[model samples]
Target: MRKVIVNNIVSLDGCYADATGNPLALNMDAAFDQANLDSISAADVVLLGRDSFDGFSSYWPFIADAPEPDDPDAPEARALSEVNRAISRRYNAIPKVVVSDRGGVPSDNAWAQTTTVVPRGAAASWVADAKRNGDGDIVIFGSRRMWNGLLGDGLIDELHLMVSPTVLGDGVRLFGVPADLDRIECRRYDGSPNVQLRYRVLAPRSDRAS
Candidate 1:
């Protein structure tokens, strides 16, 4: 079966975004570009919630190429630019699935050819069918509610929380329900001011409403 991975970058206070729905709204030094690149690279199918898909489809498609670094001598800037380019390529090419209660995506969408929107009512069945039909991993980047429901349905295989060291006093917190998970790994990046907590779901609340 294709493994389903749900990944999110959160603040020190456990919030995924500020009240305005912007992850960097509060000037939080969320410099985890490499992590984002890694996620996109490992995904064969990118799963996103309606809001996340909206935000991503609006922005990521525009990241076709990175701007030249202001200072050519600045390796860090140049490296970041390359990362952006790589993420753009993968994110745009990989097949995408959006779990939304809404109807469907417009045909003019840049990702329309590679995107599929599953109604909220059919998400579980769709995911199960996708898993059965493939061996590649289905990765969800920041669909908290979607992942939450999938977790309760015992569909999620792994949960990765990339925690940044910032405290946004008020935002949409990540955890709203209890889960049964086993620790996979908790590691701090060597040169980055972020840490990742990985977990594998041991048991899911199948009784929880989807």
Candidate 2:
């Protein structure tokens, strides 16, 4: 069976994206890029909402085609570029499922050859079925709404959250409901203001009380 892992990088205030709906507006550095690579490499399939689908499809392929590191940049910059390339390649290789109620995801479906689009109404059940039958990790990236629904359905297995140094006093918050989780691991990036947290979701609170 597969485990659903939700990986997100957010501001200290818990905002995944800024007011402009730009997740890149938050703090992300070399450590973050390496983490991204690691996350994608571990997952065989990715589940996304419409917003995340649009965002990833429009960008990841291009990054995959980007040039390798050159001598002109700093050592850290070159290392970051290498990591970004690896991240995009992994994203392109993995199968992805996008949950969108409406049409218009492009006939070509250019992000990856294995893109699957399902209606929003059926997302939870589909994920549950996949988890029951599939292998490896099912990863969710930048789909706050989608993951929250899965959380309500008691489908999310684990969460890998990176808290950056900056705080977005006001932005689109990631958590709309309370969740019960058991911390699995926590680590900090040396010389950087990034703290990564891993948590295993417990059974729903109501279930535990009964």
Candidate 3:
């Protein structure tokens, strides 16, 4: 069975969204970008929430081909453009499972491919089935709502959190449930501007019958 890994870029306050209701603001850092690309490269499939898929489908394809407007001639611009192209290419080629109430995704990009749109009620079961049927890692990026649901269900195997330096007073949080996640272990990285935290879910304890 494949492991479902949840990765996100969050603020100090746990807000995944910015004031403008856009989640990209939390992903502006270079470290976050690198981490996400690396994870995507290693994963067998990428899962997205409906809103996150909408945002990504709108931006990635176009941005992947377009160079940076401010510094088109800069080395950073070239590097970023290359990275975006590779990432976009992979996203287009990879199998994606989108969880949405609607049956189909509305996208005009040639690279846009929606494999299966499991109904809202069946998402949890479908995800579990996917995990049980596949190998390697299935990554979940974006979609805090979906993530929180999976977390609450205790379906997540590992968590890769990119903690940014900035703080948003009010916005979307990563974990909204009252469940205790204190059992998860975290490994912090050094020499990185953004803090990278990896957490593995621990097993629950149950009293045995004599």
Tell me, by lDDT, which candidate is best: 2
lDDT of 3 by residue, 35-84 (tens): 77778889888888887787777766665666556967764564455566
Best-to-worst TM-score order: 2, 1, 3
For all predicted structures, in order, the TM-scores are 0.86, 0.88, 0.82
Given candidate 2, what's the lDDT at residue 20? 84
State how far residue 162 of model 1 sits from its true place (Å): 0.5
Error of 2 at 33 (Å): 1.0
Best by TM-score: 2
Cα error of candidate 1 at position 59, Å: 0.9
- Pairwise TM-score winner, candidates 1 and 2: 2
Model 3: how far residue 27 lies from native, Å: 5.9
- Model 1 ranges off by over 4 Å: 25-31, 66-80, 205-210
Query: Per-residue lDDT for 1-210 in model 1, tens only?
Result: 888998788888988888887886432222466766776687789999998998888777767665776886775564446677777788889999999988788887878889988999899998889888986889998789888888777788988888887898999878655678899999776667788888998888555532
